[model samples]
Target: MGESSWAIDLEKQITTAEVDEEEIKRWVIDLEKNMEEEEMKTSRSIFKVPTQTTLLHKNAYEPNIVSFGPYHYGKSHLQLMETHKKKAVDYFLKNYGKPLNNYVKALEEVDQELRDSYENLDDEWKHREKFLKLMMFDGCFMLKILYEYKETLAKPGSENHDHFNFDPQLCLYIRRDMLMIENQLPLLGLVTLAAVQTGKSTVLFVLSFCYFLKLESNSKNSPYSNYINSTVFAEHTGVLNLPILIMDEITEISFLNLMAFERKAKGMGSAVSSFLAFMGSLINSEEDARFLRSKGIIQSTLGNDKAIVDCIKLLGKDMYFNPHSEMCLTQYRLNQYYLNSIKSWNKRLRDWSSNFMQTYVKNPWTLISLMVAGFVLSLTVTQTYYSIHKPK
Candidate 1:
C-alpha cells in the first residue's frame, strides 16, 4: 500500500472502532486504586534500593552477615544469624529477668504499624505470629549488641570478653550489616521491647554506639569552607568548613547506605548526599585527595589517594542534590566566591596585608629596625627644615 493510503486507513479504523465505556471506566478505577495504594506506601521507611543505584554498587546496600527487617529476612546467608539472635534473646531475658512472652506481647500490640513501616513485606512475614517473633528476636539481639558495644567502648581492655559468642570479625560484620538501609527494623519495635524489659525508653540503648560525623558549619549554619587567607579573623572569614572524613571500608559502606536511605525516605534532608557531592567536587584526582589528606581534611585508610578518589567517585554516582539544601547553598556561595573578581581581589588584598604584617611587623627585630629608620628619617627631616629656614 502507498504510505498516504496506509495512514488514512489506520486513522479511519481507529476513529470508527467501537469503544467500551464500562471496561474503560473499570480500567481507570483500577489504576486510581493502585496509585492510591502506592502513594500510601510512601510512608514506609524501609525500601529495596532502586535498581539504577544498585547497578552501580550492589554489595554496599545489601546485608552480609545479618538481616534485621523484612527486606532481607530469611535469605540463605542471613539465616546463619538466626541462632545467634535466639541466643541474644536468651541473654536479654536473663539479664533483665523478664519473661519472653511479655516482650512478644509488647511487639504484638504495635505489629501492624511496624509492618506498615516496611515497603512490600513478604507473605511469610505478614503472619502475625511470625512477624512478632521476628521483632522480638531482632529487637533483643540489637539491644544485646548495643550493650556489648557500650561495654566495649567503656572498657577498652575487655576486647576479649566473649559476648554472645561473637568474635571481633563477626561483630564487625554485624555492624556493617546493621548499617544497610534495607536491614533496619522499625525503632518502634525496639523501643516497645525496651519499655517492656526496662520499664523506660530505649533512647540510651538504641542510640548507644550510633555516632555521627559533625560537619562544620558557616555563618548561616551551612557546611564549613576554607578562605583565601588562613589567618583571617573568624567574623570576616568566608570559609566553608567540612568535617574531617575518615574513609575506610566500613565508612564507605556506611555512607553509601546512608545516602541511599536518605534518598529513599521522605522529609529527610540530603545532608549526606550533599556532603558526598561536595567531596566529589573537591577530589577529582589523586593529587586533590593527597592535598586534602595533607590538610587533615580527609584521612583515608583506603590504601592510597587514588583509592580515596575512586571511593568518593563511586559514592557520588547516581546521587541527587537539593539546590535549596544548606550544603548546596554553601557550594553555590563557594562558586560565587570563585567567580567574583571583586571578592577575589578583596581576599587577595587581605591575604597580602596579613602576610605583610606577619613577615615584617610581627617580628621583634624587623619592627625595631622599622622604628629606628622612621626615627632617623624624622630627625633628618627636622634638621633639613631648620637649615632651610636659617638660610632664608
Candidate 2:
C-alpha cells in the first residue's frame, strides 16, 4: 500500500502471496536447489565447440542497461542478490561493523532488542531484513548506486561517494533498446518499492531486469564489481552486460487478454482490437523471442519470423520494411492474423468455442464440482460475515 517507513519499526512486512501449501513446498524445494547450485560458475556440453573469442569479446562493445527508476524499491536487494554481497571484504566490512569472523561476537555484546531483529529470523527473508537494517549504518544505497555508477567509483582520486564522479562520455551507447537513457536520472525505481501486490509486484519484477542491466553497464569501472572483471584497472566495459529488454509476461497476459477480449466482444471490439492485435502480434510474431534466439543477436534460439513480420506490419504499409524493393509482407501477415482471429475464434465459430479453456472449465462435470465448492465456501464465508456484522 505504502512504502515501508523506517519510523514504523517492524521486523518483516508480514505480507505474502496466498498460494496453496503445496505451492509453498514446491517453492522451498526450488530455493534449496538454487542455493545448492549457487557456487556453480561454469558449464560445458559435448556439442559445444571451442570459441575463437569468449562471450567477453562479443559483449565488450554492447550497450549497458540502466534502471532509470527511484530509490529503496528493492533496487539494493536486487543488486545484492545479483552481485552476491556475502563473498567479499568490502561487503563484509560494510554490512557488519566488524569483519566477518568477529561480527557475530560483536553482535553478542549488542542490546537484546537489536539482537532480536537480527537473530529472531527463521527464514531467508529475516536474513534479508537483518541485512537491510545493517545497510542503514553506512549509507544503505551508496554501495549499490556507486557500484552501478562505477565510473564514479573509479575516478583517479575517488574517495567515499562524495569523491565519486560519473563519466558522462563512458556511456558511449545510449542503449535506446530497454535501458532507461535520460538527460538525468529519474525516480520511478524508488517509488515502485512498495509494489508487493500481484499487479504492482509483477510490474516491479519486470523493472528489475532494467535495474540489473544498469548495474551491469555501470559497473564497468567499479573497484569491487570485479567478480566479472578481467582488467587490473577498469579496462573494458559491458562484457557482462546483456543489451536487451524482453518482457514475456506470458502468465500475466493470459488473464489480461481474457478481460480485453471479452470486453471487445460486447461492441467494445473496435476500441480494444488495436491493443489486442498489437499484443497478439507481439506474442505470436515473437519479436523478442526471435531476437533472443538469433544466438548471434543474443542467446541461442530459433527466430520467430511471424513476430518479426507482425511488428513490421504495425508500422503501416506506406513505410514498407524494405522500401527499395517495396516489400509489404508484414502488412499482409497482420491482415492474415487478424482475419484468422476473427474467422477462427469468434463466437460464430462453434468448433473454436468448443476448444476454448473457458468451455473446458465450464463443462457439466466441472460446473457441478465448482457449484458444490462454491456452495460450501458461500456458507462458510456467509456464516463468518454474518457473525462479524451481527448486532455488534
Candidate 3:
C-alpha cells in the first residue's frame, strides 16, 4: 500500500513538470515572434511620434493643411489639399519638361524603397498602383513647394508667388506640416522625381531644401559663440557670447521633429536635444525670452516672447540629458563658471551695482541726485582731511 501511494505522487510530479515545460516553450516562441517583429520595424527611418509625446503636443507632430506620407494621408481636415496636389502634379510635369509617364516610371522603380521608409505604413497603400500614385503626388507637390520656397528666397518681395492655389496662410501651414516627423515623404522618392525632372544629379536640388532650413553641422566650440557680434554679451566680462536663435511659427515643429527623430533613430546623435535643453535652461520665463529678443540674440516672429518660452519648455520637456554630449558638458561648465562668479568679488560688485541702479534709479533725475550726492560726500571728505591736517 505504501509503495502504491509513493508511485501515485511521483506520477503527479512528472505531469506537473511536463506542463511547466510546455508553458515555457510557448513563452519563448511568443518572445521570439515579438522580437522578430520589432527587428523588422526598427529598420524604417520615419515613424509615428510616440503616444506620450503626442499627448504633450498633438498638433506639433501632426499635419494641418497637407498630408505627405501614409500616416496622415486620409484625415478629413487635410483633404482640402488633395486638389492642390493634382495641380502640383500638373505644374511638376510642365516644369520637368517631360511626359507624365516618365516621372511615373521613375517613381515606380523606387516604390519598394519608398514603402520601406515608413515604419507603419497601412495595408491600404499595399497595392503597387496606389502606393506609386501616393509617391508621385506627394513627391511632386513637395518639389513644387520647395521650388516656390527657393524662388521666394531669391526674390523676396516679387509679386510672383505660385503656391499651387494655397493662400499664404495655408502655404505657411504646409511648410510647418512638412517639418513634422510622421508627415515626411521618403527622400529617395523625392530625389528620384527631381532627377527625372532635371535630368541631372539630385544633389543641388536636395541642397536647396537643406539651405532653406540652414541645417548645418554643429561646431565643437561653444554654441553661444557669436561669430557676427558679441554686443549681446557686453555686460559679461569673461564669457563673451550669447545664443543666436531665430524663433518663428515653425521653429517648434522643426525642433520637435528633429528631437523625435534623434530619439527614435538608433545611433543618431542628440544634438537637437542638447541645444534645446540648453535653451530651455536659459529661458525659464517670458522675461528671459524677451531679454534675448531685445538683445538680438533671439529674433522671434512669433506673437510674443511667452510663446517662445512655452515652445522651448515644451521641447525640453521629457528629454534625456546625455552627460557626455557637448551641450551637456558645456552646460556643466557654464554652471561651474556661474558658481565661481558668485564667489568672486567682481561678480558681487556687478550684482550690487545692478541692484542699486534698478532699485534706486527710477529715472534720470534719480541718477542725477545720486551723482550730486556722491560729489558732495567726496568734497566733505576732502575738506575734513585738509582741516584735520592744517599746517601740521
The 0-to-1 C-alpha lDDT of every candidate, in the order given, reads 0.76, 0.34, 0.76
Looking at model 3, report the run of 10 residues with the lowest lDDT sum: 223-232
User: Model 1 segments beyond 4 Å from truth?
Assistant: 1-42, 204-209, 212-238, 341-392
**Stretches of candidate 3 above 4 Å error?**
1-43, 161-163, 204-237, 240-243, 346-392
Q: Model 3, residue 115: displacement in angstroms?
A: 1.2
TM-score list, all predictions: 0.71, 0.20, 0.72
After superposition on all C-alphas, the RMSD of every candidate to the true structure, in Å, is: 11.3, 31.3, 9.8
Q: Give the per-residue lDDT digits (tens) of candidate 1, residues 202-315.
A: 685324423322222223233223311111212236665555677866877877887888877888777677767877887899999998889887777788998998788877
lDDT of 3 by residue, 1-392 (tens): 36698898999898886557888999999999999777766667898899999897777888878899788888999998898889989986776689989988888887777777788778888989988888888888888888777787789976476756557787678777888889888778888988888887575444444533433322324322222222233224555355466778788778788789888887777766776777788889989888878877788778998888888877777566777776776677777777777789787899999999896786778889889999999999999999999985
How far out, in Å, is residue 17 in model 2?
44
- In angstroms, give how far residue 282 of model 1 lies from its true place: 0.9
Report the Cα lDDT for candidate 3: 0.76
Which residue pairs show backbone clashes in model 1?
Answer: 224-240, 224-241, 225-239, 225-240, 225-241
Model 2 error, position 294 (Å): 16
Instruction: Please give, for residues 28-62, the per-residue lDDT of candidate 2 as tens digits.
Output: 99998887444221110001111331132332212
